[model samples]
Target: MATALKTVQSSEAEEIAELVALSRAAQEQIAHYSQAQVDALIRAMVWAVAKPGVAEMIAQQTVDETQLGNYDGKYLKIFRKTRATLMDIIDDKSVGVIEEDPVRNIVKIAKPVGVIGALSPSTNPEATPVIKAISAVKGRNSIIVAPHPRAKLTNKLICDLMRAAIVKMGAPADIVLSIDIPSVEKTNELMRQCDRVLATGGSAMVTAAYSSGTPALGVGVGNAVITVDETADLDDAAEKIRLSKTLDLAASCSSDNAVILVDAIYDEMLAKLVGKGGLVLDDDQKAKLQGAIWVDGHINAKVVAQTPKFIGDYAGFAVPEGTQFFIVHETGAGPDHPFSGEKMTVTMAVYRAKDLDHAIDLTNRIQAYQGQGHSCGIYSRSDANIMKLAEATRTSRVMVNQPQSASNSGNLWNGMRQTFSLGCGSWGGNGTNNNITWRDLINETWVSKPLAVAKTLPSDEVLFGDVIAKLG
Candidate 1:
């Protein structure tokens, strides 16, 4: 048995190695592609899946295969998000000679990072792979995707579609590849062999990516918390929260897992939320929900990304006919309270704060225990309060009076770069704080020329006068 297991492991490693080599060969073939050629290939890949019938089919197939998220959400993400990503990088230069600095007499050239190993999560598999493919090819690189087991077939379908598009565009089909049969060992091997790893999944996978000894860009776990102050439009805030929490049944990491209500408007805001298809659970129901949402200290897989009715029934609680989400009252945060963490379902916890300061404290406390450095949002007409929350909380993005899920990952309403991966910086144990995009898939070389005219350097008095005065 031991020998057989060893043989199986060796075979898997060999298979991954072959995929890596194929990807490397394909990447080299495109090393000479001009900016226009690369852009055309990107357009081809985007149109292949973003077209009318194709997007719907992929969305339906993703829901059927993964048994998570809704078809409508998946479809919009597949079609609109893909095109939106294209729009985001439409005029951006990722090829040779991408930038020039006249003052510094420097020319910056972009080069491909070779093959990338991308680990996509099942929750957003349909769109994540498409986005990653576009980003990789934008830099004239190849990518091999290792998807979650539940979304392997969906991943393969998306990869194959993109590969065909590339082939039709006169590019190598091997530029986009997938591990049709994904395993822990196979994914590990791929990460180890690839030039860089783009890991976008759970904590374990991201941790593994960082540990693979290869350069990697991984995202942090998300437990997005939103704060609503007395100055906020209660009705509008409630409506946006309803839309975000119920969208795709809370499949997105940016979905509001917990909401903090200011004491001045806590009652009114809770009432408003209740009016918007939110069912505030009683103590009994809250107890039942805690048990249902978690099993043995882990989120219950069955409840994840499920409809409110399904989660209610599973938890043995009464869900009203039009109920779109469930709200449980909680006062504390930490491992002892499971609701303070990420609940990937149509359920959220509601907290009451004395004021904006308390709200920020609660937000920091909760995130520190679980989602530190991911993201948080606020619904406040008071700019002071909004800025206060933004400065106080150790989070990446702060959505102001907008839907957290729709706004955090680059929505049309915001200026954020469209992306499937959100970096959490050192706070979340990731490298960058920017939305991971094509800009991250390439390396740059700076060519410097002798300056025709030299500029005077700053004197110590000018540079350090303020610091020196403070010291004195």
Candidate 2:
């Protein structure tokens, strides 16, 4: 029986290897396409967005397969990509030819970056693939995606759909490709050999991509922290925090992991949060959830999504049944208090600060503990307070009066490139990714030169002489 099992596993492994080889071959073929052909591939992807139920079905299937998030929220992300992000790239000057000025004699042009190797995460499997695919096409690049091991089937199906869409739109047949088996070894080989790589997920994978000796665009982990000052509207802040935390069961990296409250309004804010279905766990409940929160040094997904009663029971607390979320109060912020860190599950740590400045200080501490350079939030009308926190946090995204998840992930106000994967910036203390965007996958070289004006001044003379004189 042992020998037979080994044989069966070996056979399966060989099949996966073949699939990876086929994908690589297809990517090579796609690399040979002309600029127009690449543009056609992008146009097909743009048109694919209009297909009824495609995005919705992809999102729902991913949630069902991964069991990590809510289908409704994932559906919204799909629609956002299809209707909003896709349109944003249409007719955008990222691809195609450029004409130079006759006098200036400078020509700016966009060129296709050959083949891209991308790694997608299970948390947002389908959305990540679609975002990468659409962006690659927009940049006139062919791509090969390596889905998370847990999301292989979903990734394969989505890749096929995208390829079919591109071919139907008169582009090359293999414009988008993926492998059925995404082993660490195979993925490492692809990343090292591919023209460029885009990695989205944990710190380990992003670090690997960066060290793969090829240009890589990677996204880091998020541990978003929100601060509520005494002068703020506690009711509105509570609602937004609830909305942000509960969205898709807090699977998003941008989900609010910690809440920093000013001492004057901590009780009031806690009251509103509890009123809005936030379960405050007692000491016994905290112990019960502690096991569920951490297992063998990592956060367990199953326990985090469990009901408050389940978590309480797991932590040794006797409580009512059907508790969906929990809130733990903490006096200070540090790694010793894991609750005060990024709890990806439906749990949050609330800290009380002395004043507005104290709240900012706590927020900084929380970021230092785990968040790093990702995103932070503040619920305040005081412009001074907002600016102060914004400057102090030094996070990539600082949201004001909105849920951190949506705001930090690419909602209208955040000004971040729209995508599920976010670059945690320099503050996350990780050097892998700067930010997540389609442009990050492609290489850009300006094809231009100085204008050849008939009556040009000498090299020492500035173009804007009068403007330069004003400065002097």
Candidate 3:
């Protein structure tokens, strides 16, 4: 009986391995689709988005299962994924044939990466998958998603719905796959084996993707800082800061973890902030929120989106009955200051600066202490000040007069492509991946032959005045 049981277990393991292999092989085949097929895939993805409440359901499931963010905020992210990301790709010329110059006789084309292995985060679980899946469709590639262990259920459900949509829309059934059981070992194996990898979330996973010997797009960790100068409208700035810090309980990558305020407006800003639901805690409340924020030098995952009252209770903060958000006022920037780093929660740190220049300097110091290349926010109407801060801060993205989370993700008044991930160029003093987009996932190769003999040089008379003028 023992021998028979062992044989059965071995056979089951072999079958599982075969299924994975077959799935990968099918993916390889789908990756070679014609442009028309790619368009069909995109259409299917759009159709999936069009399904009533599909996006909402995915977001709701993620929040319910993970307990990391609020449903309403996740709903907005999902809406963005469907409308901003998915629909935007419909008109984008990522795939198919393109004619650049008829005169020069140069044509460029897009080709799919063979197989993509995407690592999704626990936060924004649904949006991550939708983004990567749409990119795959745009590039005519097959994607296999390895969701974070904390988000397996949500990931599985989203993948299932997406697959159904694709099949219903006449695309291959196995173009997108999700591993039901995701482990570090399994994810590492997938990263090693896949043709291209896109990893988002914690630094550890991004590091693993970079070292996996596969072409990879890895996002850097974000600890976004926002600065409010004396020139800023105190009330407007305070309201926007409050909204940005508490949105989705501050689970966003671009959420304002630290606020640097000019001393001239510090008191007024604090007053307005407090009036707009910001909780200024006592020493005991500060200690409680601090404990709830960190665990063994890392941000605590469990307390990320919980109410301040709940976190305060857990941290043993003796406070009034009702508390919404926790605030910590600190003198300097560093690990010693918990708010200086990304809290992934509703907690924010307030730092008073001597002046506008000092606010920028202090903001730079805070980012340098941790988030050098991620992003920064400033609420200012002065173009010079905006340009000055944009130039001085080493971050890849700068948001002016708006919530950092929305602006950094490409929803700013200025036109910028929407993306959940921001690349910190070398300035964040990190690797160059300034922004995550479909174009980054697909590598381009110019298939061109040198024009034979430069198409006959212009006539001497035509060349003399025209060519000389052009040369000048």
Which candidate comes out best when scored by lDDT?
A: 1
Q: Candidate 1 at 20: error in angstroms?
A: 0.9
Instruction: Give model 1 RMSD, 1 decimal.
Output: 1.4
Ranking the candidates on lDDT from highest down gives 1, 3, 2
Model 3 stretches astray by more than 4 angstroms? 1-24, 27-36, 98-106, 318-323, 412-414, 427-431, 448-472
Question: TM-score order of candidates, best first?
Answer: 1, 3, 2
- lDDT, candidate 3, residue 142? 73
Question: Candidate 3's C-alpha lDDT?
Answer: 0.76
Model 2 stretches astray by more than 4 angstroms:
1-51, 96-108, 304-324, 412-414, 429-435, 451-472
- Report the number of the highest-TM-score candidate: 1
TM-score of each: 0.97, 0.83, 0.87
Q: Residue-wise lDDT of candidate 1 within 374-466, one digit each (tens)?
A: 889999999999999999999999999999998899989899999989999999999999899998999999999989988788998897988
- Candidate number with the higher lDDT (1 or 2): 1
Question: Cα deviation in Å at residue 337, candidate 1?
Answer: 1.2
In angstroms, the error of model 2 at 270 is 1.3
Across residues 1-472, which tens digit of lDDT does each residue of candidate 3 receive? 9999778656545543544565567666666676667767766765575356777777778888888878877887776645676655567787656447666667777777767888889887877887888777678777888898989998898788778888886776677888888778678777877778888878888888889998877777788888888788878888788778777777787888888888888888888888877788777667777887788998887788776766766787654654446678877877877678778888888888887788778878787777778888898878898999888877788888888876787763656667776778765434554567777667576667787767678677776977767787
The 10-residue segment of model 2 with minimum total lDDT is 428-437
TM-score of candidate 3 against the unseen true structure: 0.87
